[model samples]
Target: MTSQTDGTAPAEEFMDKVFGDYVGANAIFMAAIGDRLGLFKDLAAAGPATSVELAERTRLAERYLREWLDGMAAAGYLTFDANGGRYAMPADHVPVLAEESGTMFMGAAFFDYSTKFGESFHALLEAFRSGEGVRQELYGQEAAEAIERFTAPWFEHQLVPVWLPLMPEVRTTLEVGARVCDVGCGQGRALIKLAQAFPHCELVGLDRYEPAIQAATENARQAGVGDRVRFEMHDGAAGLPGPFDVITTFDVLHDSADPAGLLRAIHDGLKPSGRYVCVDINCADRSQDNVGPMGTVLYGLSLAYCLPVSLARGGAGLGTCGLPEGRLRAMALEAGFAEVRRLPVDDPFNNVYELSL
Candidate 1:
């Protein structure tokens, strides 16, 4: 009976955890709605306003804003001034949700991701049963564009100043006007940054998605680097035209249908002295080693999005968090890279690697 009680306790405890997660997810959904509707930003700017005041300021319905404000207050995202009958976003929370360009801005990104996940849930369910998933097209353009926006803060703020400078040689190569290609360059944020930073370097952004390429091309034009920065609709596996000086793929290799083939193609296209820089999720080779909320979230994303897209292409699906250093090193070596060295970077979610032939 004592042993039965022990087993039963664990089951009950697990169920408690599951219920807590459901609550957390609902809160996130409400937060995302608030973000999408600009309720949080408005409240933050107005400083302890009633739901009616917030609605008046934002031109939204008072009834909906009232309900949303109450939900946020209960979720602890907003503090309720019970005496004054008002609500407010805590000062500490403002930067996280409102400051899109700041490093601390994560709420908007997570909101975009969660909303997209919710939209894709049905397609994901079908993919689980059939082993053939919906493509990125099914998520629609908004979701596709959200990915670029979500990652823009880091790319704009860190890529040029912090990450690129880690490899002095690569930095020097780009400074000297070399041909550079960004494979799977969604929305061309990174490439645009690179183009602005190194005007001498010729830049090419490639993605299989035409919508992304179109966006990227327009983005470069808006950034005033369109003369030197170009976008191409091409699969990474098909490879770029040869003798390129530097090739970089930010969080893209694992998303490939044929990552190994893509690597080989990258190697074949590069000049003898050229280098390949890959940025991907920071993860462990074993499941047991990944022990935390971040790991759980990444694995959930793998199941919902990353794994499905690659599998849908009838290719080796190295899901999100699947490319640990050891596996990546092995694949890089097999693809004719003589060396694979990890660069020192402080990013919590990603690791950078420099591969050379």
Candidate 2:
């Protein structure tokens, strides 16, 4: 009897883990299908629909569609009614998936990753074998640029509010007209934001992708900060061009293939005792505050997608997991930053660390 119970427990545990993976894998496909097929849109318009109704309206096979709906229901993504014979997205959740504040929009990136899941796994296998993954296109320069563009708003919206209070500190160092280098400045969002807020400051956005630099330049122009904010292509891995008064990176360090080298370059690029501010995923539960859903999602992507992409690209990319302020401070010391601190960000959903060269 003990043997029977013991065997069953292990089997159940294994099955549970497998089930979790299966659901997560299939959810990625379903979410992508919903976006591409407009299935979710149809449901939104009709208010609620049975699988049969959805299939007929969508011109999909009812049986097959029902299976997908069943999975969605079981996974808490779909709500079912027995008396009414309908399935629907929970009313409260619909807005989140459909609206600007939704995790679903940001989650769209995961589908792209899911489509190339096998390649990542294979590259991971190779990495484990040789401390390296095969040369691959999964997270190359172009892909990184695209990811930055797609995720920038999602990232900025969450973190900017956190950084607002620190503006005083930022302004103190920049002296209202000092130059600031936004290294790894994807699309120049930070520069645009800063320039808009502090019209007198000079912001230079440096990135590796020409297209991204162009986009950032255009965006800065659009934001009416063109004269103050400029975007240029820089080999982010090599360093920044400076003597600038301040330098900042928004979630850039983790993506570098050689973070130590990049840090050293930035150190050399800055003016003496230049100020630095960085915002990234809190890899450590330092806050002891459980990260909200969006933060959690970014953290997961950093692990399952970001790090692997780095390894795949033959770089030493890794997510910071919002590690403790002290851990970041330690790295800054190693990187030759003079003073380091972890500051509570003014942004509603982001965290910040401040350092000096």
RMSD of each: 2.0, 5.0
What lDDT is obtained when candidate 2 is compared to the true structure? 0.67
Off by over 4 Å in 2: 1-6, 36-71, 80-87, 101-121, 134-136, 140-146, 153-156, 171-175, 221-227, 285-305, 308-327, 345-351
Q: Give TM-scores for every candidate, taking all chains together and pairing residue i with residue i.
A: 0.95, 0.73
Stretches of candidate 1 off by over 4 Å are 1-7
Candidate with top TM-score is 1
lDDT by residue (302-347, candidate 2, tens digit) is 6555566466557766554533455566667898888876676444
Q: Model 1 over residues 242-350: C-alpha lDDT tens digits?
A: 6799999998899899999999999998999999999998999997887789888788778867888888889788898889899999999999999998988877788
On lDDT, the leading prediction is 1
Please give the clash total of every predicted structure, in order: 0, 16
Query: Least lDDT summed over 10 consecutive residues: which range in candidate 2?
Result: 99-108
Error of 1 at 57 (Å): 1.5
